[model samples]
Every structure is written in C-alpha cells, then in structure tokens.
Target: MTCFGPRQQTAALQQAVPKTRVQTCNSTPVRADGEFVLYWMIAFRRTEWNFSLQRAVEWAVELRKPLVIFEPLRVGYRWASDRFHRFVVDGMADNASRIAAMKNRGVVYFPYVEPERGSGNGLLAALAERACVVVTDDFPSFFLPQMVAATATRLPVKLEQVDANGLLPLRATDRVFTTAFSFRSYLQQELPPHLAQFPQSNPLARIQLPAMKTLPGTITRRWKPVSKELLLGDVAELAAFSIDHSVGVVDQRGGATAARQRLQQFLERRLAHYSETANEPDEEARSGLSPYLHFGHISPHELFHELTSCECWSPARLARKSNGKREGWWGMSTGAETWLDQFVTWRELGYNMASHRDDYERYESLPDWARATLDKHARDRREHVYSLDEFSAASTRDPLWNAAQTQLLREGRIHNYMRMLWGKKILEWTASPRDALDVMIELNNRYALDGRNPNSYSGIFWCLGRYDRPWGPERHIVGTVRYMSSANTARKFSVDGYLSCYGEGTHR
Candidate 1:
C-alpha cells in the first residue's frame, strides 16, 4: 500500500465527505502503513447511495489501499430477533451477491452474523488494527451513536462517520423543530443545497483500488464471515442463533433489491392516490418502505432522485419563500408534495430531535405543554387497564386495537392510520401516561420491523403529543392532549378488510 501524508489524507477526506455530513469520532490519525481502508457498514448497509462507503473508497484510492466493507450483526442488541436477523441477513446476502459481481472493483464485503451473545466482540478493533482508517455510518438514534463513539476511542486508526440518514444532513441544523410545519419551513429554506449534493448513485462501480485478498487469520478464525448458506437458506435457520425466535420474520424480503421494487411499485401503482387514500385502512396507498429505510437497505437520496426524475423536478422549482405549507414548496404534483412532506419534513423531524437531544426517546422529552397536560390527567379513571402481557397477546377488549396489535405481531407492521389509533388506545387503556408510553415503546420495538429507529420514536412519541398541540375540551385520562377513539376511527375509515385481515382470531 502507498502511504499518504497527513495533508494528502485530509484533502482526500474533504473530497469524500461534506463538512455538514462528516465527523471525526476520535483524535487519531489515519495509518499510512496499514493494509486497507475499512468501511464499517452500520446504519447504511447498501452498496449504493452511501456517503460512508464513498468516503472509504476515497480514502482507499488516495492511500493506494484496498477497501474492506464490514457489516456485522450482534445477537445481544435489544429486541434482536429472528425477524430483524432474517431481514438484515437477507440484505447481507444481496450485498454479497452484488459485491461478487464487482470482483474486479477491488472491494471485499464481509458480513458477520453473531451466532451467540457476545461472540462478535472485539472484531471491529481487530479489523481497525490493520486498516488505514475506518469509515462508518453516522446515525443518531438507538445504539449506533454510543457504539461508534466507544469504538472510535478503542481503534488504532482514525474513524470517520458519515451522515447518510436523509436528504438533509443530521448536522445541518442544531435546532429541533417542534412540528412538521415548522420543520417544513426550515427545510424549504435550507434543504435546496443538500438536494443538489447527493452521494454517488452507484459508488462501487466507480471504486478503483487494490483488492484485499485475505483477512488476518486470528480475526477470520474466531469471527468467521457468515456463510452463503446461512444468508440464502431458509430463515428457519435463524432459530439456531441466540436471538428471540418468537418475533418471526414477516413476508416482505429485505435489501436494496426489495426496497427498489417497493419504491417502483409505489410510484407506478399507488403514488397518484397517496394524497387521497393514504389514511384509509383498506387502501394500499401507503409506501411500504419504512422497514427498508430503517434497516439502511435503501437510501432516502435514491428515493428522492427517482421521485424527482419522475416529476422532472429540480432545485429551481422550489418555492421562493418558506410559508410552512406542504404542497407548494416542492413544486411537484400534489401526491409527490404530500409524500415529500412525510418523507422529508416529518421523517427528518425525528432525526432533528435525535441529533439534538439525547433524551429524544424518553418520556421526559415530551414538550412542556404535553407533559403538563398528560400529568394533569394521570390519575383520572381509565375505562380499562391492560397488562403488557395482555397487550402483547392482542387480547384487548377493543377489536380494532386488537387487530392492529395482531397485524404488528404477524406482519411486523400496521396500517398507518390504525397505528395512531393503536397508540392512543394504549394510552387510554394503560394506568398512567408514562405507563402508556412504556407500553407503546415495548410493543412497537419488540415487533415492528421499523422499530428502534428515529422515525419509530417520533411516531411513538407523537401518540403522547411530542410534536402536537394541546386539544380543546380537556378529557379524562388524556387531558388536553389529542384524543382518539375506536368508534370515531371506525366512522372515519372503513377498517372492515383490515379487521378481517388481522383480526384477533388470525393472531398466532
């Protein structure tokens, strides 16, 4: 490997990551004598549209070293289950195939699946010892932030984390907007430049570096790369691992392949009706891309590109002023505008909060008014109180709530509108507001494929009025915070097919 001086390394890094999207986790310098540049694929797992991978490629080319992509799955993380494991391994399988096809590109993809608790410990440090530098994903929510911070301090080489979470960089603004309207206003003013600076659509194709032929024997012998058989085999094999097999895999496959397919399906068949029918429980207007986004199998930039290309949209089409209105800002069709609101404003709102506040997921993180209102009605009599066990078992007296829970249990997801009613009902049925929050978090993170993500926290917190204003006519158990009812939900939308599809009897 060719050695690069500090100034050369710095210049390469600057070219690789934008100032707004890059962060040095530790003070260490890149190792000039090291064998390869390691791309630790944490949040952004796909080969395409990834800033972290692009950064690694840049470092590798600059230093004349091969690139090593390490994507690992630990069995010890909270809520690790057959469902998440299978979904992630499916992606690993896809990545393995993709990288194999690019063998001439001088990249090595290593996917490691921990067979038991704590089995994969120290693997990253081992890889870092031989790497010129480590480039990884910069994600704010869940265990990723802490994990990266801890790993950076222990590694021998410099560690750089790149923000590829969304269209707007995580560090773009320090202020956390309280509502979607406010976030939309901020984005309308600040997001245009970011729209123009997307990660390379196919970064691997452009990567030109020496191929890493082998891994160190010590690291390879102990923490072996996951087998092709395991990745492509029946998900039933996941039971052998020390993870929760109770949360089984859903019907949907995971990875960039499936994510793109779902995106195309939504664009061709459902996007036009998205504005009108997205809230209807029986309609297939919702884009089923949350799981893919959560797992980093797809990039928001890629989705944005596809959408913009379809509409012939560009930064020049953006509104001249920020009025906090959702539809006009994008200068796209009504459906595209509506979808962009959810995709950019609402989804990135969670990222904004998580990036700014360490307590984003805590019950204490609720807005002052929401907490005050919820606390005021804490002791008010509840019509019914259900234990976590009963809730998890989908034995609630409310058929609609049971259906939602059943859907979550069976499919790892719920209808968009039904999920709101689901959380609100949980709040209504639980003993206290805090208890309600606890139940929602437990149920959601345990089953939903998209759980433990910033967006997931946003949705869960929204139930307790995190990003909402107080409603009028204070009510018992919910107080001034918004209230939802099964009867009213029934009146608002036809859930007959939803009920039949995920009714209590269908629960396993």
Candidate 2:
C-alpha cells in the first residue's frame, strides 16, 4: 500500500466527512504501516445511513486496508441493564448477519458485550495499536463525549469523530437554543443547506477493500467476540451477563431492521391520524421510534427521506420565510408538518443544547427564570410526598401517574402525552423541586429505553420548565412552572383504555 502524506490524508478525510460533521480528536499522525482502519462504533451502531461508518469506509478505501468495526457494550456504565443490553445485542445480531451476508465486503464486524464490570476496558486502545487511523461517532450527550476524549489522548494514531446524530450536524452552529420556537426558526433558516448532505444510505453495499480475516491474537484471546448464541437472543445466554436483571427486556426487538419496520408501519397505518391523535393517550398514532433512534438503530435522515417521498415533497417545497412558527416551514401535509416539529425541531433542540452546554443534563442548566421560579416554590408544602421506592413500585395514589410508571416499568416506554403528566405529578408530589428532578432522572433513566439520552433529559427537564415558560396563576408546589393534573388530563383526553392497559395488577 502506498503511504499518503499528511496533506493528502487530510484532503481525503475532508472529502469523506463534511467539515461541519467531522472533528479531529487528537494531534497524532496516521500510521502509514498499520494493518486496518478501526471504527469504534459507539453511538451510531447501525451499518446503514451512518456517517461514522461511511467515513471509516472512505478511509479504508483510501488506505487500501480492511475496515474493523468494534461495537462494544460495557457493564460498568450507569443504567446497564438486561433491557438495554438485550436491545443493543439484538442490533449487533442484525449487524453480524448483514456483514456475513455481504461476503468479501472487506468489513469485519466485532460485537463485544462485556460479561462483567471493567472487563471491556482498554479494548479500543489495544485495537488502535495496529490501526492506520481510528474513526468513531461524535455523540455529545451522556458519557460518550468524555469517553472519546479520554481515549483520543491515549491513542497512537489519528482519531476522527463524525457527527451522525441528526440531520443538522452538532457543530453546524455553536448557539444553544433556549426554546423550540427560536430553534425552529434557526433550523428553518439553517437546515435547508444540510438536507442535501445525508450520509450514504448503505455505505457498505459497494465497499471494496482488503479483507481482514483475523484479529491480533492478543486482542482476540483477551476480548473474545460475543458468542453466536448471545447474538441470537438466547434467553439463557442473556441471563448469564452481569447487569441489572431487574429491568427485564421488553418485547420490541432493537436494530435497524426493526426500526425500519416500525417506520413503515407508522407511515402505512397511523401517519394520517398523527396530526390529530398523536397527543391522545388511547391512540397508537405516535411513531414509537425513539428507542431505536436513541440507540442509533435508525437514522433521522432515513425517516425524513421516507416521509418526504410519501408526501411527494422536496427541498423546493420549503417555505421561503425563515419565521420559526411550526406549521408552514416544511410545506408538507398537516400530519407531516406536525411530526417534523417533534422530530427535527424539538429533537434537535436537545442535541444543540447538549453539544454546546457542558451542564446540559444538570438542573443548573435550566433557564434563569425556570431556576428562579422553581427555587421560589421549592420549599412550598406538598399535599402528597412519595419516596423514590414508592414511585418506582408504582404505588402512587394517582392512577394515571401509576399507569404511566407501570407502562415504563413493563414496556420500557410511556405514551408521549402521559409522560408529561407523569413528570408534572412528580414535581407536585416530591419534597422539593430538586428532589423531583432527581427522582425523574433516576426513574426515567432506569427503565425507559429512551432514557439517558439528550431528548429524554430534555423531556424530564421540560417538566421543571426547561423549554417552557412560567404560566399565569402560579401554583403552590409547582410555582409558575406549567402544571398538570391527572383529572384535567383525563378530561382533555380519553385515558380509560390507557389506564386499563397499564393499570395495577397488570404486572408484578
């Protein structure tokens, strides 16, 4: 293989990953004599529509080396559980099958599931020792940013982190948006240029490079790839892993395969009613794609493409005005516009904040007015206070809240509308505003599949007035933070069926 100079390498990488989406993590030079290109697949775990993988493939082709994709699951991370592990492993299973089917693709898929705490440590470092260059997902939220940063400093070869998190790159703008309206307006103006920059929908399909038949013996001997049975979703195999078994796996399988199917089902069956019924507790109009999106099993670009194609829409249909008002920007149908608001505006708002603000997940990161209003009402007496245990057990007196919690515990998700009520009730019942925040974080991150994500934090914090404004006629415990009650929710929407579905005695 001919070794390229630093300038040539930089030019090639720029062509592969757009300047807006790529971040050079370290100053280390690429190793000219290295064996392969390593892709540390952390956030964007799927094989398709992934900028990280696309970048890795481009590097492999440029260097005339095979591509090694390392997707690892660590047991020591917070909220490591049977449910999350099973979901991710299912995606690994799908990736393994997909790679196997693509014979001679020159891509090696390595799925590592840490059997115990700290067992998977140093795996990336060991793999990087022989790699020409390392590429990874540039995820801003949770522990990924820190983890990548720490690893970047120790690696001998250059590392590139690609932003595949959303349609708008995380580094596209440095502004941290405080409200959906402002963010929506910014997006309407800024997002059009990025729409044309989608990652390859199937980067692996035409990939051709040197095939890597084996890993270094030291690497394979210590960190063996997960067994075939484990990837096959064997129940007995799952039980043997050391994680939080109490949070049992849900029925929904994870991975790009299931994510695409869910997208199709939403478009075929529920999209027409989405504008009117999405907020209703009883309707199955919501997309239910959050878990998949959170795990990077699917790409927002794929969803947007399918939706626009269904509507016979294009960039030319975009509204000329840059005003942030939600409905008209896309120039699509009412339902499509409504869904895009949540998907692009609201969802990317969280990503924007997470990328710019170090304290995005902290209560202190709330807007000044929100923090002040919450602090003012923090000491106000509560009519009902529940311990975290009581809340976790779904032992609350409010049946609707309990039902939502039950749904979270059993199915790993809550209806979109009910989740708001659930959080507001916690604010109303907990001893203090901070306690409510803590409890919401714990419960949501513990059980919900979408928990521990930027959007999840956005939702949880919204209950304490993060993206919301103070309402008139401030209440006792909630202050000016917008308030919600089960009685009022039931009045506004039919909840009888929702209640019955997740009501007490439904599950242990």
Candidate 3:
C-alpha cells in the first residue's frame, strides 16, 4: 500500500509540485523587506490538509518570514444569509482555535467577519501592503476567478493563487467534459502518474518557524480578531450581522474539526455499505461531508489519500472495467469504488467545467442538443406552473416534490436520490426551461449549505440535461432532454419513509 502518513515521505507522494497547480496572478515582484507572508485564505479554509496552505508555508520558509493567515467572511456576497454566515463563522472559530494552539510555533491567524456590507474585502489589500507575498485558494467558480484577478491587480506584492479544490488540478483538462463516461476514461488514464502527487496534507508537520513580532496596534484595532464568543459557536451574534437571517443555520456544525470527525465516522461505519445503499433515501449511509467539502473545511486529496492508504484495492484487481459497472476500478468493496467516483470524478467534472468555461453557470451554457430540445418544447401547454416563492414555501401539489424542497429548506440539503427528482419536478412545473433554471439556482443557493458550488451548478444543470443525453419517449416541455416522474421515482425507493422524514408536517 502507498504510505501517505506524516512520517513516510516516499518518492511517490513527494514528487515535485506541479506548475499547473500554481499560478502567479500578478506581475509584481516579491517584496524583499515586508512584515510577513500573507496567506489570503478564501475557499479552502482548513489549517491542515490543505495544498494552498502548504504553498504558503513553503513561501514563508523560503522568504525567512513569519506567516499570517487572513480569512474573511463578507456580508455582501450574493445569497448571503444567516445560515451561510453561521456555518462559515463556525469554521472560522475552529480555525482560530487550531491556530492559537500553533502560536508557540509562530504561526498566526486572523479571521474577520464583516458586521456590515463591504467591510471585509479592504482588509486583505491593507494587509498586503506589508506582506512579502500574497497566496490564496485558486477556486475557479462563482465570483472567485474575477475576485482574485481584481485583487491581484490592486495588491502591491506578488499574488499566487493555488488550486486546492480537487484531486485533479483544475488546469489538468483543457476542455469541458460532455459526460461522466468520457471524463472517467480520461481519469482512468491520467490518475496513475498523479496518484502519488498529493500536496503535503499537513505542511506544519515538517516546518520550523521563525518567531515574529505582532502586527501594529493600528491595523489590529481597525480589523480586530474574531471574538471568543463568536468562536464559541454563537449564532445569535452572527445573525446580528448585516446579512439575511431568514435562512437559518442547520443543526449541523461546521469546521475542520467537524469535517475530520465526520470523515472518520463515515470511513469506519458507512464506507462498507456506501455503494450498496447510498442512493436509498431511507438509508443513513451517507458521508454528510458535502457542506464541509463545499466550504473547503476538508480536502478531496485528504479523502483520496486516506482511502488509497487502506490497501483495500490493488492495481491488478482494479484492472476490471469500470465503464458501465456500478463499481469503478479499485478492488475494494462496492462502497469504496462508488465513493471515489462521487468524491473525485463527478465532483471534479464540475470544477473542470467551471475552470474552462465562463458560462458554466449560465442558462445559455446548456448543450446544443439540450437547448434545441428545450427550445422545441418552449410553447408546450403546461399542466402546472409555480412561481419561485411558491416553490420556496413548499406549497406544491405534488407530495414528493414538496418533500424534497422542504428537505432542502429545513435540513439545508435533500437526499441525493430525491435531489434529482426535485429539479425534474421544478423543470416540469415552471413556465419555461429558463424559468426552471433560475428557480433552481435561487432555491439551492438560498437554502443549501452546499449550494453556490461548482457541483451545485452541475447538479442543477444535469436536471436540464447539461451533461446528460436524450432518452426514449420525449415528453412535454423537456423534449429530448431527460425526464423524471414522481410516481416512477416513488416506486423505486421508500416514498412513504422519505415523505415522513422530509415531507409535509415534518417542516411544520
């Protein structure tokens, strides 16, 4: 088995860092005499098991400078709400605690939660004024690409953006994949060489630090460190921030600590049954790690490394075809193979698309066949059409659809099986295909903690046939674009169980 623990640094896992994974967003030369190496933390928020964090540590060592991690939670982003803010703050609190524990080693972290709109962004540029270099997470989705480009231009020092979003670097593929089969084929051939090339999951496990003085009182006063009360997981204080509070936080906790705990439990308990029962709405075999992955509290590389280290599968055994098999490659139990497909290939497919295409989230970005089919049925008579507000309230006539939406509203996520049906019903009931897209985006973004991610758009678009192909018996409105039915989906799973768990009265 490949050794990925802190002690064993074999040639396989210690390969030279790939240049494709790192990019210099600014032309500015690195500052020779500066206060510290600034890690402008954004998407990937974890202290350890982070590629971008590892890059920052290397730069700090090379420059003989102390490292200061700057993380911010802004109130002004699209679909910002109490739930989103609370989840982020909880993670930040976890980060604050971990960083405090590392203070003896001279690593410092400061998280800024904006009390008002436009309060947090200026702090990064302000901190950059004294930094030798600015390194950040190179996530290529939503406003991140544009935000990083703009920040790089304005910062006085060198700005390096590192891709820590997935097992495969976003730049690895040049073209957007049309389907999972094609992407998996590319993945099968490409994964061997890169298997041992994971970033240092715990950079601090090896680094020795130089003690540095604290920042000036003026800067600290202007942008104070997050309070212990906030760090203690107080949502009431967070809700007082100038963001929407209607969408409340879920009962679930958020942080690297929480993520690590969840990962451990899933591996030990649910992994064996993962493939056998992951799609069953009535079963509890899920990892529940999506929100953590979405928030960058956990790393996909970390997940991949832990799984690979198990020695559960060998290359010889994995030679079997994964093309159409429910299980892919890896000689491990059906669970492990199925999980690797979901956690790596499917997740990264969306990241790959977002990295290559600016229109990844746009309605017009749907495939030619999908668009033509949707356009062909644009004028088809609709039996039911509901506005976005009605959908949000879960007042629909269909029990199954209402259950899915309420699941999203109450739990901040829907079961994986029901999520597809949720989108399919929305598409069927909306006035037009475009209207369906808009409503799906709005509801997902506002409610789900895992929303506003590359996968979110991928999942939503999949319902509209983005990465899917035509099916038999083209139906109304959807045309050749694939279709799903409540009655049909209900028969496949325990509909009564699902309805009770997430349907009407469950919410009330």
Candidate 4:
C-alpha cells in the first residue's frame, strides 16, 4: 500500500543519515489479512514520534487487523529490583492509559511480569501465531540484541525490527569510530535532509478488541507504596532485595508524564546551561531523560518533533521581502540542535557498539590501543586493593570517590562527568583491570537508575578503554583505559566543591 502525507521515516533512510538516525530494516513486517500485527514494545515506550509504533499501526490498518503491543517484564534478569520494576510498571501504566483512550486501536499487555527466565524465551512465537507480522524495537547492545536474534530465528511468521532509539540509527554508519568526532561529522551532514520532516503516527482507524475493564494501579500504589510515613521502612525492606541496597529510588519517578515534565523543565530552565553545566555532578544540568529514553517512555521521534518546532532550532523558511513581514530566522538558535546532536550522535554511538559488538559488556571489547596500553601496565603495583566489600561500602580512602559512590548509592544516579571519574577510580583502586571492570559494572548495574542501559554499558566500556585513545606514557592501574585521576578532575573542575555537594549519606 502507498502510505502518504509526510514521507514515512524508514530504517533504511534513517540509517543513511549521518548522525544518530533511526532506520527500519527491509525485514520490517507488513500488516496483512489473516494476520494480526504485534509491536513487541521492548525499547521505545512512548506513543509520540515512535516509528516502530507508526509501523505497527500502518501494518495493522493495512491488514485490517487489531494491533497488540506486548511488553513483558521478567523478574530474574540482571539487576532486577523494586526500583526498576516500579519504573517499568509506571510506563506500562502510561501505555495502558493512552491506548485505552485510543478506543481499540491499540492494546498494551504487560502480563504482570514475564513468565520466562532471561530475555531468551520464545514469547513472540505464541504472539505471532496468527500475526500478519511481528515488529520489535531494534536495540544494539545488552540482552536485547541477543534476544532479538533468538526470537527472529524461532518465529514462524515475518519478523521486523525498527530502530527508534537514536536520532540516527547506528546501521547508517559506514563503520564504527574510536571517538565521537567521526560520528559527529557524519551526522551533521545527513541531519538536515533526514530530520526535516517528522513522521506522523496514524493510529488504527477502527478495530474492536477486549474492553479495558481493569485499570492498572499507579506505580506508587502497585509497588508496595512508598509513603512519607513508610519511606524509611519501605527503603529498608527494598534494600534487603540485594547486596547493595544502599541506593534508593528518588521521587523523580518514571513514565511518560514524569518524562514530559522533566523534559519541559529542562527545556525551560536547564537548556540554557546544558552545555556548560552537564559535566558538573552537583548541578542538575542534564534533562535527566535517559532512563525514560532507555525505557521507551518517551519516543526519541517525539522529542525530535518537539525540538524541531522549538524557536531555537525550527527549520528555516522562505522569506517574503515585500515589507519584511514574513521570513524564517536566517540563523536558528543552536540550543536544540546542540542537544539533538548529543542525543542522536553520542547516544547512538554507544548503541551502535552495543548492538554490533558481542563483547560489548565484556572487558575484551576495549580498543586495541586501550588493551595494549592496559596490558603494558598489567602488573603495575596497585596502591590500594580493596575487596568488593570495602569498595561497595564506600570505605575507600579517596573522599572524592567515596562521595561519588555515596551519591550514586543514595540517588540511583550520578553526575555524568562524575560517573566517568567514578569508574576510573574504581579501575585504579582494584587489583586488576578485569576486576575493576567487574566492580564498575556490578556497582553501576545494581544501583544507578540508568544503569543496565546502552549508555551505562558504553560508559563502563569507555572507562575500560572503548571509543577512546590511549594517552601519554604507560600508567599503572589505568593501562590504556584513559586515565582519569582525582588530581586531574580537581584541576579540570572544583573536585572538592563537587564532592561536598554529594557528601557521604547526604540525601535530600
């Protein structure tokens, strides 16, 4: 069928864009008769700017079949917790609300948790039995890719995956780079033409499905409820779930509403200072939207749409010179463009690595230079070799590292820059590079709200020498993994001042 209006952003065209583009593979399933369309909502969570959702809707209408959006939350996966569970349930709640309001066009079924063990189950098999086609979110790294591979192989029907996370999908890149410069250059060239038109979501016109008799409870209520009176008690109980229960979920909350509010607040209050303060751990410089992005609560496409409409970066238009009454701003402000660059370029760069590289989560994925340099100093005597216990307890002698750890422990996240420094210090304090990598992953995946994401893995890999170059003469602990010393951070910024804000046990 000829789909029209604005051109649909396909994964192929998206990949052709230079920057982080979201592209649809040729394998993307089409909606047809005698088959229902299934949108396996594994990644992109929101209803807006969602190409995958658009694809699912288009196919559903084409086939005149109802669409099913299935999001299964398995409990025993790595780093599963009440915190993450609550965040996911929040998004599920949002999905239910929106889909329900859409009549019977779409149905979101979470199954109250995955019945299988890991991401390696054949859940899609049953869903796709009579499916016109099955479409899933194309994520590069983590268990998502592996799961996709396994599911695709087992499916009896047509299977397609759509790239919706990055502004430009990593498939667009000709090759991976050791730094962001190459990726940035590519994206800058392709963004204008590709990102010019935002793809519109056409919900299924009319389809009959089961009625929404039961409304999913709110996240706060469903997850055992965290009240002002029970905050301490809830935290204490939640802490018992894991070894490092020190980290607690914040009131920032999760889901579409929270994500939208955070974005609005960032655009209004923080966008002006994003470039300057993003690195400062103490300042709320970031939009704090990564978790939402990771969970698919907010569609990157929607964000791109909103960003393009903003005064700072709206597309230029023809000028009417009669009385100088009508014209496009010759020079659009770069704020939105700058943020978009970060969103698509840098963010997807990480996803590209995670998606394509098998060893993304493993230490061996470090660049050749990083590995070589690290091995050169493999036997370098460590100043302090604390056990994971000591490290986990924040008993390190370095007050700076301790403070960073405490912040992550209390807030479930850390300042973006401080996180890098935090990982580097762990590398230095541990006995071996492998051990350091292990420790970093363990602590991060366990605590940070944004942990276990592509960015999280990419950040850890960066500390262990991915997407970076070896610097200077061989150093002791860091090897080639890009040495980031506390002294260097102190010189680079006010380390003492930064740490003072997230001092030990300081939770607001």
| Number of the top lDDT candidate | 2
Per-residue accuracy of model 2 over 1-508 as CA lDDT, tens digit each: 2222232323433445677898899999999799999999999889987889999988898899999999999988998999999899999999998888888657888899998888888888899999999999998888999999999899999999999999899988888899999999899998987876777767887668987787878998999999988888886787878889999999989998999999999988888888999988754689999999999999997898788777777677789999889898888888889999999999999998888999988889988988888898888888899999999999988888999999999999999999999999999899988899999999999999998889988999999898889897977878788988888999987888887788877754
Error of 2 at 207 (Å): 2.0
C-alpha lDDT score of every prediction, in listed order:
0.87, 0.88, 0.83, 0.65
| Tens digits of lDDT, candidate 4, 185-290 | 6555555555544444433335454333332354213432222322222444343343223344566577898898888888788776666676765455778888
Tell me the tens digit of each residue's lDDT in model 1 across 308-341. 7777665667789989997897888899999988
Question: How well does candidate 1 score on lDDT at residue 27?
Answer: 93
Per-residue lDDT for 1-508 in model 3, tens only? Answer: 5334443334424644577789999899999698789998999989876778888888888888888888988788898998888888889988887777765455778888887887665788789999999999998887888989988899999999999888778887787898988888777767655665677656765566677667667788887777778878877787668888889888889998889898888888888888778888844588989999999998887787667565444345555443534354656667788898899779988998888989999988999999989999988989999999999999999988988888888879999989999999898899999999999999998999999999999999999998899886888888988888999997887798888887778754
TM match of model 4 to true structure: 0.80
Looking at model 3, residue 436 earns an lDDT score of: 94
- Candidate 3, TM-score vs. the true structure? 0.96
Candidate 3 weakest lDDT stretch, 10 residues: 3-12
TM-scores for every predicted model: 0.96, 0.96, 0.96, 0.80
lDDT of 1 at 245: 87
- Give the runs in model 3 whose Cα sits over 4 Å from its true position: 1-16, 311-328
lDDT of 1: 0.87
